[model samples]
Target: YPAAPQRFSCFGFDDVNAALAAMRFIHASTPPTELYLRVYQLESRQLPRRSELRPPVRSSPCDCGFVGNQDDEDENFLAIARAMEEIVDDRVDCYWLIRCFVNQFKHKFGDSIPHL
Candidate 1:
């Protein structure tokens, strides 16, 4: 299993272990606000920004397309996130990791990518 934040909590036996591991990682690091377990599911992926997961427009056709792309992005982010979670401990916080990733992305896709 990947070592990221969790969601769909309250699963059967297997999930408890995942959550326990994740909690251990989170506990050691500086805690954040509104950064729920589900979000950890996201952080585990090593994404640059949380806003990218939010929707720009609600109840629209374009929303669907955006969702599909976001899912793919999320999956990729999770891979790196999970890997980092495995090694990183109290010294680093998820915020710094997220900001660093996001800034780097902004730098690379500057002027070309939309506000992400």
Candidate 2:
């Protein structure tokens, strides 16, 4: 038999300091294994300075056409590139970060994490 799925919700903040404070509190209260982190940013008009030149616009409309803002699409691509860069950054120690998070959890909640 499969185990039951667990679910929980925590406060989300847009401000960096507030978000970090919330994370610290949550880490101290909950087991790191049970914590789920979700990061997102609101869409803004600002775009990266290194975007490529826009593609030539089609003169005549075709049966199949893309109906969307080209600039927005470019911005989305830039965002994806930035995320990939972070994922591959040599200085980012993912395992150490996870251990630190888990240690914080253990420091407050003890060795065993309560199952929900």
Candidate 3:
């Protein structure tokens, strides 16, 4: 949360490129190369480990007929999830669902998480 562009919002901000841009901007640095390194480490952990960033390194068969990397269960899950979470009407949105999920479990998480 270092030098984040402050915001006051009750409306949805997730799934918007604007929010991503703001984040990228906040962590931006010109000639200060150190920022990029920190940013990479932060972002790597932000989603998943570096290994998970790429597809499975190797796939081998075992006793279960087929055993391999199932899939990247990180953002990929939420990508499909958000699309499917859309309702037929305006009663609920992906944003609300994500907010609800974070609210429900954020407390259980450690202090690393700032807010929902």
Candidate 4:
């Protein structure tokens, strides 16, 4: 059978912050009892000039170890990585919030959505 016609709804925003605010609103509408929802935020950035100036070196494991532990730079990067991980762990709810929004749209539209 021919694939059912799909209807898509797009809410364009001037910037990411506005989109995030809308996501939070949708997340708030989700039922409190629901759990295990998944969401993700994919971000990208241009290479920084400082990084370009640094010498290329093999990456070391995040754990404290003697290998590649030749300088303070390694320790600094490890600390930064740990801090970033903590931030991501805390923001996991943001993903769920966005998921809730998508689910709501799906439910409201029913068969109109097949692959959001």
User: Please, what are the lDDT tens digits per residue for candidate 2 over residues 9-106?
Assistant: 12222242255346442334532211212122211322222244233222322222223355433333333333344464421233234334434644
Best prediction by TM-score:
1
Write the residue-wise lDDT of candidate 3 on 1-116 in tens digits. 63242232223232232343455532333211222222323433553343444322222222112112224222322333334355422212443454455345444642433321
Worst 10 residues of 4 by lDDT: 33-42
User: Clashing residue pairs, candidate 4?
Assistant: none
lDDT of each: 0.40, 0.32, 0.33, 0.33
- Per-residue lDDT of 106 in model 1: 45
TM-score (C-alpha, index-matched) for candidate 3: 0.27
Candidate 2: where are CA atoms >4 Å away?
1-67, 89-116
TM per prediction: 0.32, 0.21, 0.27, 0.20
Per-residue alpha-carbon lDDT of candidate 4 for residues 30-115, written as tens digits (9 for 90 to 100): 32211111112212222123333332233454533322222432333333344444445523343334445444643685454322
> Model 3 lDDT vs. the true structure?
0.33
Model 4, CA-based lDDT: 0.33
